[model samples]
Target chain A: QQQVKQSPQSLIVQKGGISIINCAYENTAFDYFPWYQQFPGKGPALLIAIRPDVSEKKEGRFTISFNKSAKQFSLHIMDSQPGDSATYFCAAVDTGFQKLVFGTGTRLLVSP
Target chain B: DTAVSQTPKYLVTQMGNDKSIKCEQNLGHDTMYWYKQDSKKFLKIMFSYNNKELIINETVPNRFSPKSPDKAHLNLHINSLELGDSAVYFCASSLRGESEAFFGQGTRLTVV
Candidate 1:
């Protein structure tokens, strides 16, 4: 129940197109969901996040669509660029447990 | 200034050797974490320290140990390293247990 499953282990999108990555969690105790972006040889960095209270959150070109009922969430990158090519990971945090569980990363390649 | 910094970006050692990875955060965050990313890019939490206190241990092997000298520093020491221990280790810090975390450039460990 602690797992956060992510889909499309690899994705290829053209520049100026939309890039989407999906994730689903089984634990309802998770109150916070965050997406992280990691470049080669670099650590994962926070890209955007959302809480269960809201259905969606958007930050500039990055957006997080969440569904509490389905226990699912997704990250959408608008106007995808080659610079956006990297590994994206979805994570859920259970405050009571005081730990964040991560999903298997999705390697996104935004082609030029 | 780097928010989170870890030493020895790359480590190559034999299976029977031991190694240590040092991590420090200038962010003054109360929570810190150690995460391991395998060859398949699967990220898993190894340990967590809050206020310099051990808070989370994810059933990792006894050979793996974490030490937090202070809130600003957390370190991982591996004894009797095995080939399976080869992975990219990341250090991260957060304001608290359920907040956005900042990660350092990972340390890639290769146990041959």
Candidate 2:
């Protein structure tokens, strides 16, 4: 199917806390998974990405946890800050068509 | 430099009018795409072009047309816009066979 399901349509976290967003896919053909961060009036920017070969990928304060067996993945933001408040989207891409199937989106808020 | 950019960030037009949105990517990617996000925040791929050639076209009304003169540029044209056409459209690009795709800020189209 062409769906990447995401959870917690909205989330609120205090500064210095941890924020997590989860996503799952039904298609096993997906090879690339990426997370995107978007601020109001801006396009979604690539935060971090991981392939099925690796279990996880970390970039600065953001980390992506991937599970090939469960067909699920998650994004973790360490030391949440107000500036980190934004909408996060998780997407999966199949190798054959290279078409991206995006999740419903999660609005994350980090309060200071 | 902006990897991807779209013109007229906000477009408010009346029904039955025709309008166009232009997109350009400085990333020198060989593939460009158009996606639409509705009120529910579901992002759906509408069109994709590689080397200025149309590769994929999802189910959409005939009123909508996509043109790409080259790999760096892709534009969308709409004729006889309807109320249901109101949505935020995003242009994105990536090098062929790559995972991450750069996205434009998005054009918010409101048809009244």
Candidate 3:
């Protein structure tokens, strides 16, 4: 079963706009949530991560807003640029487990 | 220097062939993982190792095997490969369970 579910498999955003992708997990035990970005022909790289304890985390133009109660998290890219176009994946893991359950990815295309 | 690296960015082979993808991390992390991404960009974990010991093995096929020579390296061997095995394989490393993971550029394997 897919523990994590992401919506809007594809997204389009204009440069300087805000691009948001949302994810939800069914496993309540999941405590760590992370977002990764992958360009074509490249590996997924960790973009930003957040824990359930905090409601949100901001890293420059990227931010992760996590809602512990809803078991949902969203990544927002502010001032999106063409370079920000990439495939984004969200993953959740239990505290003591080495494996992570990833959501169906979102392909974001930012056009100038 | 690249933190995590994989050999042979592209692998093209025929069915029933046996192949291996090697991964090494210079970050001195104790945990490594192998992930597969499919046509629709669904990222899934296949295996994980910690300190050269198997820790997590998902419901992947028996044809897939993982070997870890040390904490810095984890290699995946796929035997009797089928057309379904054609996908992008990624290698990742983390400090431990539920921590941030660093990924290597994927290996695109096309099975004809």
Candidate 4:
């Protein structure tokens, strides 16, 4: 019940195209959803986040689409670039618990 | 300045050895956490501390223990290292009750 399942373990997209990664959570208690980007040999870093109050949140070229009813969320990258190629992870957190439940990472590759 | 820093970026040890990973956060956050990323790239929360007090502990093995001497520092101590113990460990910090977490440059541990 604590799992956050992510799809497309690996994704390849052309530069200037759109890159999308999907994730679903089982626990309805999760109120906060965050996406993290991790380069090789580096720790995961916060990319964008959204709360149950909002359906979507956009930060620069990164956007997170959330659906509270479906218990699902996705990360969209506009104008995908090679620099954006990395492993992306989706995580859910119940603020009351103060711990994050992370999904299996998605390795994204943007071809030039 | 790095927001979260963990010592010994790479640690290679033999089986049955005991080791420790040190972590410190300069973000003045009241909550700190330790996450382990397995070979499958699944990140799992092992422990969490708020204001130097142990709060969340996942179903990790008893051989793994976490200590927080201060709010800014959280350390992990592992005893009887086994081959399965090899993985990349990350340290993160966040404000209490907030969802945004800052992570460190993970420590890669390889047990032979």
Give the range of the ten consecutive residues with the poorest summed lDDT in model 2 chain A. Answer: A93-102
Which stretches of model 2 miss by more than 4 angstroms? none
Q: Which clashing pairs does model 4 show?
A: none
Tell me how far the alpha carbon of residue B35 in candidate 2 is from the true structure, in angstroms, after superposition. Answer: 0.8
lDDT of 3 by residue, B4-60 (tens): 999879999999999999999999899999999998888888999989999999899
| Model 2: DockQ score | 0.81
TM-scores of the first chain across all predictions?
0.98, 0.97, 0.96, 0.98
lDDT of 1 by residue, B1-112 (tens): 9999999899999999989999999988989999999999999999999999998999899999999999999999999999999999999998775568899998999999
lDDT of 3 by residue, A1-112 (tens): 3489997799999999999999998888787898989899888888999989999999999999999888899999999999999999998977587667888999999999
Best by lDDT: 4
- How far does residue B15 in candidate 2 sit from its true spot (Å)? 0.3
TM-score between candidate 3 chain A and the true chain A: 0.96
**Can you tell me which runs of candidate 3 are displaced by over 4 Å?**
none
Candidates in order, TM-scores: namely 0.97, 0.97, 0.96, 0.98
Better of 2 and 4 by lDDT: 4
lDDT of 4 by residue, B39-75 (tens): 9888999999999898999899999999999999999
Give each candidate's interface RMSD in Å.
1.3, 1.0, 1.4, 0.7
lDDT (tens digit, per residue) of candidate 4 on A1-112: 9999999899999999999999999898998999999999999999999998999999989999998889889999999999999999999998998879999999999999
Residue B37 Cα positional deviation in candidate 1, in Å, after optimal superposition: 0.2
Which candidate ranks first by TM-score, i.e. highest?
4
- Candidate 1 lDDT, A1-112, residue by residue in tens: 9999999999999999999999999988999999999999899999999999999899999999999999999999999999999999999999777788899999999888
Poorest stretch of ten by lDDT in candidate 4 chain B = B94-103
Query: Model 2 misses residue B33 by how many Å?
Result: 0.5
